[model samples]
Target: MAKTFKYAWLSKLSASSSALLFHYFPLRNLGYAAREFAKQGLKPGELAIISKEAVAPYERPALSKAYLFPESPARLPGFHVCVGSGGERLLPEWYNEKGIELILSTEIVKADLAAKSLTSAGGETFSYQILLIATGSTVIRLSDFGVEGADAKNIFYLREVDDADKLYEAIKAKKNGKAVVVGGGYIGLELSAVLRLNNLDVTMVYPEPWCMPRLFTSGIAAFYEGYYAKKGVNIIKGTVAVGFTANSDGEVKEVKLKDGRVLEADIVVVGVGGRPQTALFKGQVEEEKGGIKTDASFKTSVPNVYAVGDVATFPLKLYNELRRVEHVDHSRKSAEQAAKAIKAAEEGKTVEEYDYLPYFYSRSFELSWQFYGDNVGDTVLFGDSSPESSKPKFGSYWIKDGKVVGAFLESGTPEENQAIAKVARVQPPVQDVDQLASEGLSFASKI
Candidate 1:
């Protein structure tokens, strides 16, 4: 005998002894949280996942990475939940096997915290004993800033599957055409490289003096910017896209820069930033740092309700301050923590508090970099960081109060990367800056 899952729009439902998860964007954490529930003694039919996407929970980072590859692009079921973290690939069948109801493409229009009910746009209501909010973040759009002609065709923003599909179609339609990428953040750098790989004439524009200024120091940016330049990407820094011109077909034609330079474009991509999707729970939950504030357990102020992923502003035990991380790594960990806390509470047991070590990484054409811990304080560049190096291998360390507070590595081996991660977590003290630079990866390995 098999159990059938109920669709959200088909009928009203109640789960008096169950947990319900609501998520948008990436649901990798949601998948992990469900697994944790089952592993911690929750029975069949005790959990459900609600998402607006038609597909099951998958690795959202793939949308910008392998998904855009010109050859043999990544597809669903392959990059599904948990795969990004080297876990089992959780397909829709996995949910069925686990008796977890997957309510896909169901948008929850209203939420009643007191009633513990969520109403769908189709007029169906669902009630739950426990709620997990993992709504993630929404991409910031140029239209929000009143950028003229932002509504034109062939101007894309990659956030969801639908957006990626559209961009893929444009890539095929406008092969070997010119592309102007706006904003020099993660999407800007990655997309510029990807477009160039597809043989598109690519140009990157940013208002900052360097790309990825939020994390990359000038020295680190120099290597990447120079590499991009060598790859035939025109780097336009310290300027912004002010407006756009469209053809009669409503396709974007030209990008008007604030510096008074107009770039002819067959396609355009913007990656300014994203905002946490906490608007629905604004008055219902405690918020700090533009995200839903949670404890170390990822439990919100609301009883029996938890928040995770990009929407959560939890205590960074290392820094002793509340912080919101918009990366996939934190999202995955927070989701697991919330699930553990819920199950532990039921059994009158406890789990360890989350003490997260910040990690961020990016991958471009023949280049990959990983950063751990905070990027504040004085930085020391090490190794051959030159863009012209045949085999570029370099790293940087952020020293604060004579302790190695952060580490960034490029072209590092598995053991070397682990060493850097350990250094960041241990916060090893350094007596000589010159020695540390010269020693480079050796210093971290010895730590």
Candidate 2:
């Protein structure tokens, strides 16, 4: 099956003097980049190769969402690149049809930026005139922090398709069991909700006072915390998982906390966070904030080498600072912009610099929230947050310099969400804090 899929994506090749290479994971960014380059009239023999460590390019985000559902699990070709962006799915056959090479399960261990070459773990060297690095990020594991019993059988840290499979199987095998979710980020939150829905008694443990401390304000966290509690999920905040105890079969039995509380657990899921996969080019490239440093065009210091997705820390033109965005939206746009820039450079033409607006969203249970722009300045939370509200609706506007710079909403209508996005884009001024808070979605609608 794997061999057939690989060859099905193999197209006619030619002896080209130069080639374009993409070293990435199963991310849509590289797919978009390849599509963009082809759209730019890349010659047939130019040689476009996409090498990935995964056996097939599938959706990574679904590993925490649809893949967890016991009834209908997401499978291959369904969640491939572009589909998530409302475009045609790029299956293995799609690559072959385009004459682009699809090199799966090939890990590029070494990259020589100056020489414009890469060395695979299998001792094969690939030379490229242009290289796009979209290796993405790696999930931080309990072993990274010296947490004991992390190697237990039922302990999982999901970052790939295989990891998701193991987690899903565990959920099936241990029905009505206890689950301990470590971390308070999107992964933890989403996984907890799904596990609880699967009949597992889930206990979420995090060191922050509320969930998603990185972005969710205390007011925003309160609603989610209350909602989860209502769903019978045990919340353990302001605490960290220190260790784990495994039974004789090497399955986690209990999770030890910093507060001397040991919670019984049949399964453990960790989502502490992840660091960019930049070690491959550690000294060979410039890095900022633990990610490869790039300009507005996603070009690295080394000529002809462009970095996109989670690996590149490019300048955020909107905020006038350097940032490495992890969201899928930024990854897609950055990859398209970088590919266009590369084509323009080849044609002796110049393109516009990337001017991106930060956007992030997460959906769990019946609730979904989206945030756009920076989360700085005074927060004006509006709408109903009470747990008893039949149709709960609430949002927050970040007021910076008397203007709305960021907005987050829960249960917002489509039009209301668009209004919030517009407010963030325009950074409209707020007349009065009290009025803005009272008006809520109305203020954004007017703007």
**Tens-place lDDT digits, model 1, residues 244-271:** 9999999999999999999999999999
lDDT of 2: 0.78
Which residue ranges in model 2 land beyond 4 Å of their true spot? 1-19, 45-49
lDDT of 2 by residue, 1-447 (tens): 111111111100111112455545435666776677678876654645545445435557788888898677787767887777788788877766776666666666766668665666676566677777777777898898788878888999987778888999999999999999999999999999999889899999999999999999999999999999998899999999988999999899999999999999999999999877777678888898888899989889988777888888998888889998998788788878987898888779989989998989888888888898889999999999876677788999999999999999898777888888998999998879999999989888888
Cα lDDT of model 1 overall? 0.84
Q: In order, how many clashes per candidate?
A: 0, 0
After superposition, candidate 1 runs with Cα above 4 Å error: 1-18
lDDT scores in order: 0.84, 0.78
Query: lDDT score, residue 357, model 2?
Result: 88
lDDT of 2 at 316: 89
